[model samples]
Target: MAANLFVIEAPGKRQALAQALRAAGVRDVLVLATIGHIGMNPQGFKPLAIDSEYRELAYRLKPDRERIAREIEDAARAAKHIYLASDDDQEGDVIARDVMRWCIPEEDKGKVLRVRLKSLAPSEVRAALAGAAPFEDASAARGDARRIVDRLIGSLSSDEGAVGRVQGSLLLELQSKTPVAGVMTYVAPAADGRGDWTAQLPVFAGAAVPDEIQAIAPLAVGASRQGTLANHVMAHDEILLSASLATERSLAEVSSALQGLYERGQMTYPRGKHCAVTPEAVRRITAIARASGAGFVPGLFTAVREPGGEHSHEAPNPMVIGLSLNRDLGLLPLDEQILVHVARRLIECGVPCEVQAPDPQQLRGLPAAAQGLAWRRRDAKGAVLWREPIKAGYRAWTSEQSLLHFMSKNDLGRPSTIVAHVSKFLNRDLVTQDFDLTKKGRDWSAHVGRLFGHQNLSKIIENYIEEHKKAPSLMVADMIEMCGLNNIPTDQQQDYEYEDFEISTGNFP
Candidate 1:
């Protein structure tokens, strides 16, 4: 007779488990999927109605779920034994609980087993089958606590606050906590009349910039290499935005140059998700940098990139160091050296700094409103503006900052899965940003806050779920309490209104 393996969700892991069990010599193994949950509160806020002491909390199978159930039932009929194998997370635990409620029967209860796992491998699968432990119904109960709380919140939130649904089918992935505090600036940059203000902009070797950048405002007048440089910044906005402001050369210039290269087909795109660096990529770019001879580092690097969204992910750009033009090109000037420092540091995480002589008067300017205005002599000790005065925009986040910049730091979300969550929301049109939230997005936020009680609703849900995990018996009570509290979206509430939900309008006379 065939044996069945019923997994509530995670087709990938379930498939792997099936393969591993078979490889381990457990023949007659048939793996099946549930897609997700089959049972949940069917209609309204009242989900706790009891029925025949089985707690018939009504749950209707979703269309996809019904299909999965049919397949599993067919498999179960052929099998003498069954296994509930799901993921390692709490969500997986809840899925198992649902599986037990549905597929397994009381008469054949002893023939079924729960297979716990950390990873899916032949050895692990074999070990699980041999030890077929009783279902940790309590563990699944913890997940039920979470599911119940989510349902309660979704069903009963009051009309005073707005409700927001983030991207991702599962709320656990989208929910997060952010810090409520941030740092304040109490200082200013050293004033050097000659200090090019554009250093605030960043640079890359082959970046591009438009000529209009230099004409954005008065700051562009006689700006370093104005005509050529602004184009460079526009050309290299990516690199410029990516570099530290503390560096000597205008990050604008560097980034713009990099952009120009790309637009001109001289370089590859900087914004990409590739982990593997091409050998030709390193060689061709390096040779060009050495020949055309740009950047403070003119000699060529071995070129290495890190994986995925880490702080210092590898850039596709090949870099060169020390052009060594001595008499011809001359040593990298103090300003130039600073610019290079910013670029190198931009690729890594955190702040980069170096000690330099401070212009006295510029030091004096630190205590005033001159902070915002263009530092004509914000640090002027007569004519020359001292270049290194703890400037606000001087030091900046690098490639690494993009990984940790928003969400967690801003108390928007957590680190583990925040990035993907934000990306998903962006894709779903649920959230928008330009330096901050758009009007529609802000309106949505207001709606959610109004419905959810203006307090930390995300935290409230998180705590509720966590508490339920520890005490399964608390689930029904918690869910009941949660659902009784109204806060669904106004649109959904209106559309599903009892009055709107009508039966046959025309009667047969």
Candidate 2:
């Protein structure tokens, strides 16, 4: 019999899963990697045969992808069965469907099965193989919808002489420069009988500043200080990802490294959103913590899964790789240290945190006054003056402990994509690692474009998005109505030119 073929999205995952299958006593398996999406639809000034015309996408594969597809096709022809073991996410589902389309011929399509493998552990892979299911079209449909909409918007924007939505908006924001703003201060009496503390309230240009805020009656607002967040330690997924931008690691390097780790079966699936802790992981990490005696309490914690997340895997954990907490983390390199930090965070999330909920009885006899108040005023140079408010209740810099507690409480971005987005922003020169503003000044062209070139551009796109929801129809009507393509004929000619497609901002096309 021919070997059973297993297709994964990434090469690292392929190697990892292959190892797991072999370890689980599976034989004659040909595991291959698609290396990500093999194809994408056309963008830019492409020929559209109809209004709101959804282009018939011809997916162009790279040379390597073509080779891989051919290999899979040959294997599919000879194999008794095939497994679509892509990532367990929407994008991954789409990739699996696309792979099926390209690699498995009609006759051998029936041999294809989908296995959701969130972790590369041999045991989970074995279990998944036993319970593999048929590929779902609904999952692929969502990805298709996103792709179609993106293409439409991109094509339309290109025709209209502008970049995509965000870049266009950024260009508009670069118009007028404001002068230096002044600061204002105010004092509010403390409820705890302490002296008055100063507060700085933000003021904006052309807005009237209120001289004083009236504290009608002191409402006993319960407040607790979580502590200041640490610069070295990552508290949440976003912060962890942003660390890549600060470090020497490029986005590609980080992605490849993490994927390699996952493939090595040393890490869990890196694409998790919430910092949820499993009982088993917690127990193991607690043991490690106690054994290491890292000067912190190994508090046991119970973490609930965040609602509305992908929910396929737990947050990225170090224990997936059997990381040793007792190992000297300080001696490790930056990358290894990062993994260690992630591991520590995963364990810390479930440890019983001390979040003191305000007691109603504790404030029974406190003085009643406005909890906090500030003053604001307008300056002559279009700058606003702000007075800071000194809050009466517990307020302090956010600490690492409080940061972990907060991450344990809220739903956040996937551990994988957080770093990706952060790195993207950094690469774009949008912000600095030290949280400094890099692009503070405005671009004259963007301002001019926003004012005259595409005044109603944002509104039109918004309408299209809203209408697309009601009916995923072609954007032809929108193109005709908003883009002023009224006279353009929707016929076989395919040569209709948008002669009036000129934005006053410039020929951004």
TM-scores for every candidate against the unseen true structure = 0.44, 0.60
Give the whole-model CA lDDT for all candidates, comma-separated.
0.40, 0.49
What does candidate 1's lDDT look like per residue over 229-346, in tens digits? 0111111223433342323234334444443433332233333222333333344334433443333121223233322121221333433333222121125543343334333322
lDDT of 2 by residue, 376-464 (tens): 11111211111122443322211222222222223212343434433333344432332233443133234436433544344455445
- The total number of steric clashes, by the backbone 3 Å criterion, in model 2 comes to 25
CA shift at 361, candidate 2, in angstroms? 18
Deviation in angstroms for 166 in model 2? 5.3
Go through the candidates in order and give the C-alpha RMSD of each one to the true structure: 15.7, 11.5
List candidate 1 stretches off by more than 4 Å.
4-8, 12-15, 43-56, 156-432, 438-447, 450-453, 467-473, 476-509
Per-prediction count of colliding residue pairs? 74, 25
Model 2 misplaced regions, further than 4 Å: 23-25, 48-55, 122-127, 157-162, 165-236, 242-256, 277-280, 283-287, 294-299, 304-311, 319-330, 352-509
Candidate 2, residue 259: the lDDT equals 59
